[model samples]
Target: MPGTPGKGEEMASDLSQSLPKRTFKYQSSLPPLPVPSLENSLSKYLEAVRPFASEDEFKATVQIVRKFQDGVGKVLHYKLLQRAKTKKNWLEEWWFDTAYLEVRIPSQLNVNFGGPGPYLEHCWPPAEGTCLERASLLIWHTLQYWNLLLTERLAPQKAGKTPLDMDQFRMLFCTCKVPGVMKDTIHNYFKTEREGPCPSHLAVMCHGRIFTFDALCDGEILTPPELLRQLRFVKDRCEGEPEGDGVAALTSEERTRWAKAREHLINIDPHNKTILETIQSSLFIISLDETKPYSTPENYTNMTLEALTGNPTLRWGDKSYNLLVFSDGTFGSNCDHAPYDAMVLVSMCWYVDQQLRLTDGKWKSTLMQTVIDCGNVHFVR
Candidate 1:
């Protein structure tokens, strides 16, 4: 399983009834990443090195390049071809470890990428005092997106008819990066409807406390009002209680240090291990921060700053995605770069922003009524 790309969650073909298996079927049929020829590789390497070297240094580098290309480089290239004979993507494992997991630094602002929620422009932002409400509404939309993946309704992404790798989309939910003494590992708990039962719970972090509840009730996705109730309960529960131990901040520490801390935490208390799994297995984390980091169309500096680097203790930085809900009803996200690239988040943001514009930050689906006691609020925007 080490070199395998997709989490061995592929659907079986012996089923009696046909189902939507396009997501994986196409991926399986598509070509594996091709290995470039040695000449191209060394030529590009020399081109890259040329810009950083002076005339004499460049000449020396060229001589070294030629000697290596004709000598050791050729041998290495032969070995690479032998390795490729057994594996389709020979570069995946090494590239993954070298580029991400083997790095020891804290992931926050260094390796992770985040920014202000661009959905705030053009009357698209939520009003004041509706942070929880707006968050619930946003969660509902996000769940819908998850359902798209589950049902295989989401079309495969492409670059001018050439399909792009859709593996990262699997990491969008129910995924967390687990730290180790030497390297980190990604744990993805998501399962498509065809793959069988998966975690439907949602985790909320507030006041340095973590809380989780099922995002689905009676086998149906929770309505906006229902989600609002859960969010409100988390808010009320954290308000009067003493602050929690803030274990999440440990995820913001160096990888090796965090790994040791996690080990000690589990060793001291069996319950601590369960708590960690509950979070890692959930859909994702929703962070309720007290600061507004107020933003406007002209200036998103404060919000962007808060989202990328604010409140080290408030978020589980290793989670695949952390939806940051500010006190003033705006939004942003911080995510682990282990399982996916930033473009996936950008595409999701674009989809949700367009969907929000269509519905005005609310849903037009069923279970729309004044249910919660919060002044008989109507869910219909």
Candidate 2:
């Protein structure tokens, strides 16, 4: 009966049988980009940040923050340009490239983030002349600014779009570290070489991001050396056309390497204990870029969190909860200094909580009461 079939018909049957079945649902199309309201709200938000500092201190702080933004923004902007320039006949590819540097500049600068004291954000006790406090304040301001920029990017002006989540927040956090640390370390190291920033090496680890900038500076100049700058942002080798630009498909050999690296990162560092704990139990790491082959130690934490949040199996204590919320969520607050920097973290949490409330219906007014009340006021330790 098969031999008796027509030649054209049989060929069609065989071809259809050999092809894989298409079982997945087809996605119709991507929706248009959202138009966020934050663009209009940004000015208002920043203006609100102003009254938190005195007129003189606020003006000086604004200038310093601007300079900091300009310096770091230039580096980031130029890096993007250089990357585009290197692609073979890159002009053709420019239209498709959407990379951008989002900058966050705070409206005010205050050392009393923790409570009513001379602390940078909280009650850690200010160092001599309050240099450490000021430097920490700068770092906090810059970080907050970056978050604002990111929040603006993810504004829910468009339909069917959700606000940006923790993963995007993580990307911004990592990227800002280089510039933020560099700015702080340079300002503080020269200003107070005798006391240094911290009393111990642990301080160095806590603020290690600053070291990247220090390593960039040779000695005489504040700017990074040309070689270091080139190394950090430039990519000479072509990674080749990759799939999805999200989570890269890895080979068996590569997987083994990643497994080993993960173990080392989780087991080796005492300073990273909090980060490791999050990874072992309740942190989620979603891939921001899928096409690239590179991965971060952060991914391990993300992978674990994919299953463990609010799960009964994992019993994270007060310390763990605070760490997870502080690190994972964009919301910042004042808290115990033992697990995290209560000074910076507390202020950040308070700021974020206030901001989020503003976005939600809970806060009736545009200006946060805390901003006015807590401005220059310290939290009781």
Candidate 3:
């Protein structure tokens, strides 16, 4: 009885037996990542240093490594083993915090990925009077793809017929990196199928002004026509009102500097913290850019660089994704790389591209007439 399987384990075994084996089926059965022997590690290190070190230096380094392996290293190795015994993946948390959260560089140029939208040859080409129209369609398709991820309907991604890890895809929506002094943290609002509620609000930026409105109404994502109406309201207000102070510029500063500035701003006024929280919690940022398209794939590189670093005022550098809609209906994305990899964005963009091609970039049937409230986020210095 002491070694017998429990009810949960028996059920899990039965389910595994009944279901057809597929990609990721054996994920839980994989062996834990092995830790290398200290002797082996030191031997490899000595081999690597031989070419770079003088003979005398190599001898001294070898002696140092020998002492380390015989002393502190053994204690540390035992601690690591104890940690491995308690943790499923010992390196995951350390890797994320060290590689992303603890880095002091500005995330825009250092940790963000930017690329142009794939709409040139497809149904939507560079043209006037198509910016909002194309943007609505793109948003609709993007939401549909997001729904797929939410429902776990997306097929497992693969490379050369081998199934790849799908964990990063879950971070594509409602994820942002919150800045801190020593280490930042990722705030993710994503939920698995049948898990819980996910954030459905979208942030829109125009002329340095930020707005937030629900992208879903009555348990349904807004139709493209409804999205168009919301975009028109933000665009028209931006055209009429003077540009507000670009608080988003502070995010592009060096990590420590931004952290200090953020603290000072929050101290000056508590409302600033609330605004920061709002932006961080939103699903994603949609930038209604006033610039025209570069009109060529080769020029996309420049466009992407601009989208990454162009206007600190109009872009949230820490958001997982910033959808930039140019005046000529061309689009691009500036994405922070902390929560996920570039492949997630690529997959979503590809889905939107294929949907656009299938429908010729036109919304079918009667447009929705719902009027949604969109408000500008005001910040006080």
Candidate 4:
């Protein structure tokens, strides 16, 4: 019985045996997604002529030509005329005499200079700095350059010409206010004071009120009258310290004193007077259509002028726009062609910053977003 095992024991021993196991492997095969080309995304029409390096040269040549045409069209057609028509009230230290000349605003001003698209303009040199600041600087520089050309041509130095004084300068800005509008807070100040309100507004108005600085200048001498140079000189003297008869312009300190002595215009804020208002009023909106070639920037300038000074019937649609402004917070029969240039607008913005500093009695800061809403063209000094 010990030597012989039971049938159940035998079967149990056989069942305890191990069996072979089969294995299956997984093969990884798929690759990663490709990144899209940035150039291709930015310009859908940009074609790749070759995988070779020479392909770049051909593309550059074509683009440069296109850029040249765009720049020429913009500057000749719109930019130059806009510069001629849209004057800025220059600050005291920066003011230039334009009257000693005869500068004419041609019915149609044209130029052949070429470079780049308006948007790409600031990028050409790449030395102009970042996009935001460069954009502002570009606009500022372009206008300045054009103004200098016009001034040199129309108001050149002549023999036996007397420079202008303050009273004459201030008179240039006394254009009728736009009808039906409330009196500007700054204007109220000028009404009470003998000297005037703000220099910046006065400056801008002086610049835009005149017909043409170019019409008056020729070669080394200006036209016989010399009213143009005299007027602009008066503007500068008013902004700075003018020394002469009572005919001379008021200095910054003198103006400040007058502003302080004056009640209606003087406020807790120093920049709140007409001087600051002059700068604020010169902001303009220049319209541009990028659709057609040879459609010069001047075309747009003409369009803007028409909107401002042309017939009511013509002042409608896309053409009906405003490029020049001399807002005094008032509206009367004479609103359309009030004075004030773009530089004056820049000065006004700076003046606001100065006022905030003086009023708050601290380092003043501006919330440009707030400015966009509360202190744009409508926010008079």
lDDT of 4 by residue, 1-381 (tens): 111222112111111223121000011221222333333432433343334437677677558645754676444545534543444321221221121011112101110011222222112222211322322222232222222222221122123542222111121222222111111111211111222322112121221121112211222112112322333343453346432221101111122232333333436556645533333233221211111122133343432333234322111111101222111110101121123333333332333233223323121123121211111112122
1-381 per-residue lDDT for model 1 (tens digits)? 111112111211112124444554577767866779999988999999988999999999999999999999999999998898888688889987997899999987688877878767954464679888888878876876676666665667878978777888889999999999999998999888778888888888888888888776555566677788888878888898888778889999999999999999999988888888888998988899998777987998888899889897778899989999999888899999888999988877776676677766665664344443332211110
On TM-score, the candidate that comes out on top is 1
Candidate 2 lDDT over residue span 1-381, tens digit each: 111212122111121233232111111232322323332334454577797988897787667656755687456556655664554333323331221111122101111012211122223222233222222232323323332322232222223543222222222222111112111100111111221221100001110010112111222111112222222221111122222211111101122343344355447765544443322222111111111111123333332332223211111111111111111211111111112233334333444334333333121223222211111111111
Q: Which order, best to worst by TM-score? A: 1, 3, 4, 2
Runs in model 4 lying further than 4 Å from the true structure: 1-135, 138-160, 164-176, 180-294, 297-381
> Candidate 4 versus the native: TM-score?
0.20
* Candidate 3 per-residue lDDT over residues 21-58, each given as its tens digit: 44234456555667778789889999999999998999
Q: Is candidate 2 or candidate 3 better by lDDT?
A: 3
TM per candidate comes to 0.89, 0.18, 0.80, 0.20
TM-score of 2: 0.18
Quick one: ranking by lDDT, best first?
Answer: 1, 3, 2, 4
Q: RMSD in angstroms, all models?
A: 7.4, 26.9, 8.4, 33.7
